[model samples]
Target: MANQEPRVLIAYGSKYGSTKEIAVHIGEVLNKAGCATTVCPAGEAATDLSAYDAAVLGGGLYAGRWHRDAVRLAHRARRSLRKRPVWLFSSGPLDPSASEREIPPVRGVRRIADRLDAEGHITFGGRLDESARGRIARMIVKSGKGGDFRDFGQITGWAQTIARDVAARTGASRGT
Candidate 1:
């Protein structure tokens, strides 16, 4: 068979559960692609790196920052990540009229990426729920500019690409 299914760990830091859903979806996509995938909340510091061959990390962005837990996971895994493939993603920018941007300018994020030699970093549009937000976020949603902005097509496409790359790496390592 293939090379042990190329274990992949998908960790996410989510607020109001959006980012967690995204991470789970990525795991599903990768699993369908024949990769063994594990999905977890980054805050848990769960998913031991020894069990995975590659990793993808994501978080919900608030005020130009990735969730603290997500940053912590990246740092915690830095040494192990250096020996494997790594990818990063952030969900942000609630305004539909706004130009969508991926990847926040957080120093911790960039530092982790550099340490791990990340494979890719993506930014995705986010979901804004008035009921789930605070005064400011709720006010912003009330201003007639809030909804789920995540692009599934783009997310899935990226996951598929990762599937290909991870599969290749595993196969190569197995001498396939």
Candidate 2:
């Protein structure tokens, strides 16, 4: 199976669509790098984790919590995720500082990733559109916050690293 390329599943939960966009972008980067990838909302992803050789799981952070669906997906796929390569990510900082240090896991979310032995976790910047804001969101925006903080270059760079790791582990790198 040295020649077999690894398959990846990208699962995400988004309260208002930011995380979903990030997940899709990750999938695109991996696919372009020669991995087969499946993208879906965390709730709709397969429970049979073995179907994917690796996984990239994440969701938006809101009110110091990971989305419920992201937690559920992790629990449902726990066994498989533990046996394979898994990475976790969260999109939450309305601030532009999306470095790993800024991307703290919300409440109980860290425990799930620790249990799954995920390889790494990323905290990317989030986007807030004023037009889509509810009254509360509007208030937050009015207080001098809220805008698109997502960086496509940063997202693709991380996914590219994952692609390299997958190829190395599976011995599936092209031009070999």
The C-alpha TM-scores of every prediction are 0.88, 0.91
Model 1 over residues 59-145: C-alpha lDDT tens digits?
A: 888888899889888887778777789898888767542234444546666776777799988778778887765787787788977
What's the distance in Å from true for residue 60, model 2? 0.2
Candidate 2 TM-score versus the reference: 0.91
Model 2, residue 52: distance off in Å is 0.9
RMSD to the native, candidate 2?
2.0
lDDT of 2 by residue, 65-167 (tens): 8889999999988988898999998997888788544566765777987899889888899887766557877877787788888988899889999999988
Tell how far residue 12 is off in model 2, in angstroms.
0.1
lDDT of every model, 2 decimals: 0.80, 0.86
The clash numbers for all candidates, in the given order, read 1, 0
**Cα lDDT of model 1 overall?**
0.80
